[model samples]
Target: MYDHASRPGKPSSKEEDAPSPDKPPEPPITRIPSVLPDAETSPAATSANNTTPASGYAVGGGEDGGDNGGANLRRASTVPSPHFALPLWRKSVIIMITSFTALSVAFASTSLFPLTSEIAGDLGTTPVVVQVTNALVLFTMGCSGFVWAPVGRLAGRKQAWIGASVVFLLCTAGTALAPRAAEEKTRLKIFVAMRILSGFEGTFFHVTGQTWLADIFEPTQRGTATGFFLLGTVFGPAFGPCISGIMVTYAAWTSILWLQCAMIGVGLVSSIFFLPEIRRPGDTERRKAATSSVLGILKEFNPSPVFKVMLLPNVILTDLTCGLLSWSQYTLLAAPRHLLNPRFHLTTPLVSGLFYIAPGIGFLLGTVVGGKFSDMTVIKWIRIRGFRLPQDRLNSGMVSFFFVIPASCLIYGWGLQYEVGGLALPIVTAFFYAGGLLMAFASVNTYCAEVLPKSRTEVIASKYFWQYTFSTAGSGTIVPMIDAIGIGPASTIGVAFVLLGGVLTFITAKFGLQMQHWAQRKGVGSP
Candidate 1:
């Protein structure tokens, strides 16, 4: 009774004969459906592609375009689907390995702090010169993101991770074997150069590692994943000084660098075998094109995008907030050695270094708890509003900003100022302070990764650009500021900046969507 091919949309015999021979045939209609059908057609998907799934989520570009605007719009469509879906256990393993890799890099960066005097004496230099090496490493670490972000873009994240680890391992060995020169200046120069090379390895772990995690996890699960990843980052600085204090107490200062070399070697080998290439489907072609020639590679190295991300109001606010937090973070790392050594009249590096454990534990707990809490907050807000926005996660940071950080910083500072509770008070306060910092950090870090998914690596690089610029300033000047104004006032300055950052964060959370629309309209971060 019915013909199979004669559907309502198709023309029957009479209609089919109406067209002239010169008329061109219409192209076949193609529907490239999403993995999750509901996601592709949902109301929220039509707006901005922000939605949570019941079990797993779908991946696709925003309706308007990829976050990099028109220039990357075509690339967004070409982005390959993930090669394979990894099991949860396998995904966890990858995250853990990358986190440890990050930890090793961070540990090497700050290990010299507790051993500054020992390193200076051995090389016939002053503590000032040794301290300059610390600032140089931090500065280099921040700037290295520019170079490595492009490498990740063109060469593949897997290669970037392995390459950085190998280079770090070699550089750590070089630092350990640095020859002592007759002149202090010459020896210092060698150490500075080696430290810079080592610092270059850090950006891969921080930037590319985060980028990799974002690639694997869904929005619902990303907060938890990012939190765990940050544990390695936050704990490394605290643990670095703790370990270095013990090492310098018994072993030669060079032994610390040797230990870093060994640890990094393990990470390099593990990453080579375990880390999979999670490139998009068409990314292989993109990678080949990007690497076709010297000019292609250089074209991929454009740092303009990193600066352009800063043009967005939300991004600049987040960057400034992170910069403010770095002031306190570095102050915490640098001050302990200076203040504890003198205040307690301690002789051994081990005793002074033991003090770092309190904050280290705090940093560990905060990242884990804060990360889980952020996810919960997102879920709760989704139920209330029936949709999710990236800024919703920022509400979790408010507690850390208003209460935990300010109170603990005051107790740590003024407690030392008036000598109220001795070393115990400041140590306990340091624990809470570090905890608060990480809690706030977890929300912001996750937000950055989600803000511009199309150009996530570049956006993240921009974050670190401002974040570490302030960190370099803090690391270089915190001790001097303590000397000039007393610990209480210096710490109060950090608290003021924290409050300002908190206010900005609140404003961004409330108006972030509007700001994003403005950014999109103005083409602020267009490639």
Candidate 2:
């Protein structure tokens, strides 16, 4: 619920937002609350709320510290201070632990990729059957966030994580211990069901973790903090198959599940003992007071709100940006084995595992460097304009979107197509392509949270929804497409999508304010 000239996060009186020669102008980044309001904020009512402060404090927080605006961000929270009070160290620890959940879930999703033969043999099925189940796990992991993120939004974030953890642990064990003696059909059904359910439990880590982290972090801190948070998601894919290969060599295929279970066990223990509730104090009592029946509580899980968020012009456009980027992302992740194996005659598991190091290192470098750059970009814009729009962060990713990815992907594709530079060329391109992919992804992920400050949960859910949809499509089709068309041509098609994503980012960055105005006038964002 941002006023056109107002700072982001907290809404305020129009008088406060207006610039004067006497007072300091609005800072580019406004402070967000230490705890987000658990319910949706009515942005359409911004007109009247403009006459009043959002809470007791001035909505414009002190840009330098607790000095300039005389506003404390925590004053925006409705709950008593103690419940939402998290020390700095606690916040870091929580984020660090939450990173592992994303890593572990992503780890479990692909750990079976290298052990398809072992899994199929145990179930008395073909490797193809095992592969299909794994693909579904990845797909379900993305789709499930639409369901679980809303639950975290309406219930407590801590509660949702705890429930998911326990369920995920149980489901992983079910997959691990699926009896070999059973009929193949029964065993496969159990295997698929448990794996899919575990995936469902896993996807919420991104949505819920980001939301909780957002609640505590200020606007300026979000980009770098998010980089840390997303570290797991970007690296997990490359690392998973590497570890999976190692596990199946020395231990049974079930060792992957056991490892996943161990990670879940740590997460469960940490959630109970270490993770503090991010909800407002007495939030439970308030929910009870507000809702009369079990049906009322269950209604929050309905996904229409998520789709409604999808209707916002800027939001939908941003989601499309992510969806298109995913085509390139999964293409990069999926293409190496198919493109490199025959081209370079590299077939060893170690060779395959080692190849990931290039992209993994690139992803690692991008997240940290790109995240810091995003924040710097936002500040640069704010200093120039005397204010910041959420979309200002998009400028930082332009390098990757326009130049790094398209250029690198094309070279990688055609280099393979012509066998021009030998194996080294493809590996080099993978690093740059992967680096560019995550560089573009980092700012976009944070923008999803920023674009709808009040509806961060739904907006982010929408992000993962579209991200995974395209990811699943690309993963399923890339190898076949490469076989049909040369890698260069297929990659060109992917680059076309990446170029479209850049155009979308350009539009959002340029016209985001107007688009938000249009969404409000059309009442698309209204409850």
Model 1 spans > 4 angstroms off: 1-84, 180-185
Native-vs-model 2 lDDT?
0.74
What lDDT is reached at residue 177 by model 2?
Answer: 83
Q: Which digits, one per residue and each the tens of the lDDT, describe model 2 over residues 399-468?
A: 9999999999999899889999877887898899989988898888888876676678788888888887
Best by lDDT: 1
Each prediction's number of clashing residue pairs: 2, 0
10 residues in a row with least lDDT, candidate 2: 65-74
Residue 83, candidate 1: Cα error in Å is 6.9
RMSD of 1: 10.6
